[model samples]
Target: MAVTLTDVAARAGVSPATVSRVLNGNYPVADATRRRVEKAVRDLDYVVNAHARALLHATSGLVGVILNDIADPFFGAIARGIQATAAEMRRLVVLCSSSADSSSEFAYIEVLRRQRAEVVILVGAAPEDAAYRREMAGHVRGLRAQGARLVLCGRPAPNPHTAAASVSFDDLGGARALASHVVSLGHSAVAYVAGPEGRTTGTQRRLVFAKALSECGVSLDPALVVAGDFSRQSGVDAVRRLLASGASFTAVCCANDLMALGAMAALREAGLRVPEDVSVTGVDDVPSAQDVTPGLTTVRLPLEEAGRRSLALAFSGHDFGSPVVLPTELVVRSSVVAPSAASARRKLA
Candidate 1:
């Protein structure tokens, strides 16, 4: 017979609600009461089999991962790391793509919760929305009560007080480093290709990128800032708009390598040369960043390591109430250089 919550409560000499509180760690329970509940759980040998046994190398249940888009290389690299770790533990992984939609994200999360997945990792940054926050708060509470884990990858935790584990790259610092690099190369007039508006990741990077340039005595002209959805096509469209509007800039800073590559293509279409007619730089030093003609100057994010660490945090009894900010590095390549003589002449004109 399966040991129920009532049975565990009876053995602990407490009410079912008390046992729930202790197990969920949502409310303040006396240490003694918590110990009694834990002891009862051990005596029943019910909860341990679902979790502790897995720590002892028993094949665990399903681990779910919901990504913005599995097709994007950014998410693919992180999922690769997660798959590697899950494979070692002989666990089955369930992967889903949410198409970067909140409705889809919540639906998949609920489905995983019903499956009693060992852990569910959300691997995208949803746009900031009040309704979504309220829904996420409810999901966090529900996941806690189910004795399952919720991990946020590349997204902010609903609240710092919650037990949700999160790991993200240092996007602000990377933006700062990349901006400083562009400023140092003597390019004052710059265009910025940003990601979707209201996305926490894009907002954080865009704000810092502009501020860092200002601190270096360069004003990031608001007229030159364009929004993209972190896609090559969006980057192409943004550049075409700038060209049509006759925006004068010596360089363009893209939000990611894919966008930068597209920007390079658009510039070539306009009869301009990279680092000669204009310099270009991007964040996320993915593998293809260096494969282009001039090679992209980008920031290297530890994406795979983030996946591995997030999974480790799921099983380890560590307090993950706050986010873990991994470091980022600036990689210089042939794509960026001092403004060329012809570009300087045009800027002055």
Candidate 2:
């Protein structure tokens, strides 16, 4: 039979209530009495029931993180910071992957709520659909009403009335800076590799890139605009189709580092040299961005810092209706250069 608090109490010659107070540290017991209960617990190998403790406190000591994909390095870095903060607070951190699916995201949030999670953080960009925003607002309100901290990271405000804190990087600013850098190198004919259209990251990044290009008096060619799923494979496939379609471009700007790497691979296979034959750039200067051949010149986002800040917001006892925006920096590397004259004349055939 499993050792119980009652067993420890019996062994200690103290009432079960006194043992509970000593174990929980909720009530002050005499120093000698505390030491006796501790020794009895050790002797009996007694374990406190977490479920019973939660019933008493109404919280499970859990901090839940919902991310798009755990395997993706983008989410991995954020999870690291969240883990570090949760450890400092002595809270159990659980990462739930949503696979960027609305249904899965909803289900995970609901499950975490039912588990009585102390905090629930939804990380990364949100879909821009009105239906999704409305439904998610309801869920966020529900979690808040239950006294659970709700944090939205790397996303725009879903509802002003919902009690949720927001933390996000400047998606528009980063993409614009990335686009301006590419255009400044005299790459007028540019190809845009973007995430899915419905997502805020994909749709907004593409719009800002185009807007920055127009501001620079350069036009992003419609024929060269390729939609990708923000994956390495998506980058490869997008470039392959662009090449197959006989598109003319001197530069390709991708939404994220992984897709940029994939774009480089596809271009290399087609005998195109980065920056020499064609210039390439990306957003989100992830670790792999620097390690890859030729290096990726991209916008740097404070991903890990965003993670830590979300936890801080959760515990601040105040809700942030507007997002707490984090800053972004441009990292110049070996991947981008002035487009070569030869790049413009080269034929895909």
Candidate 3:
């Protein structure tokens, strides 16, 4: 005979509700109670085997993951974390992309629901569309009404009465630190290669960078700032535009690693050696950062931790609006150096 909740409760000398909370990883259950319930489960040789149970219970042993852009290495690391954890728990993950499209995101959510995904994880920055928020919240609430879980990775919208949880890293603080470091290096005439201006992450990083520059008594020249979507081509364009303006910039800070890599390429094409002619730095210590020529100095965000916490929140059924801030750090490498006299001469002549 298969083990039941009743058998486990009787062995643990607790109510079925207590066992349920423990098994479901609900935060309200005491640690002692959780341990006792776990012991009882072990004594009874209990196994979840969600696959078999799901077949009978009409629940899918699957989790749905939606990302803004999986092409980026940062999101790829996060996706690996989620997949690893899910596989360990004997569950499958269905990956999809919203492509930063609110309509497409809504459609994907509906499809996940129809496919009976017990939980869904939204990765990367939340869409800026007000309609996206309303529709996503409604979908989550509707899912809860029918009993399901949702987890928002990265920046989630502010909603209190929704069945959702979130995991994110500290964007403003990281940007501030990066900008401050550049300022401390005595680079007053610095250029910024920002991500899409419309997106929250891009805007937040740019705002913090500007604020840090102001705090350091450095003026932000509008001509020195270039905004583009987070892409290698955009990075190339931004750097090319900055070069075209003939601005005397000593350093370049890119919003992401790919852009930074591209910026380095552009500098080379313009007959400038990285850190020799103009210093360059990027966010996210992606694999390429270390492998790239001269090694791109960058900030490292804890992608795996973000993934693990996101899954934990979803499984525990926590409130989604509560954001978790992860730590970030600056990684020094061969890409950055003091301003060069020749670089200044080029700007003047």
Q: On a 0 to 100 scale, what is the lDDT of residue 58 in model 3? A: 51
Tens digit of per-residue lDDT, candidate 1, span 1-349: 8888899999999999998787655798876676577657655754535663443232238899999988878899899889889898787889999998987887787667646787889897777887778767777765665667878888887665667888888877887788888888888899999989988777877887888788888988899999998889889999999988988999999988788888999999999999889999988788899999898999999989988887877877663655788999999999998988899987777
Instruction: Give the per-residue lDDT digits (tens) of candidate 2, residues 97-199.
Output: 9999998898788667657799999987788889999878777765655568888888776866777888888776776777778877777888989888889
Name every residue pair that clashes in candidate 1. none
User: Model 3: residues >4 Å from true position, as ranges?
Assistant: 1-58, 158-162, 347-349
Cα TM-score of candidate 1: 0.82
TM-score of each: 0.82, 0.81, 0.79
Which residue ranges in model 1 land beyond 4 Å of their true spot? 1-60, 319-322
Tell me how candidate 2 scores on lDDT.
0.83
How many residue pairs clash in all the candidates, one count each? 0, 0, 2
| Candidate 3 residue-pair clash tally | 2
The C-alpha local distance difference test score for the whole of candidate 3 amounts to 0.78
* Candidate ranking (TM-score, best to worst): 1, 2, 3
Q: Could you tell me which 10 consecutive residues in candidate 1 have the lowest summed lDDT?
A: 51-60
Q: Which of the two candidates, 1 or 2, achieves a greater lDDT against the reference?
A: 2
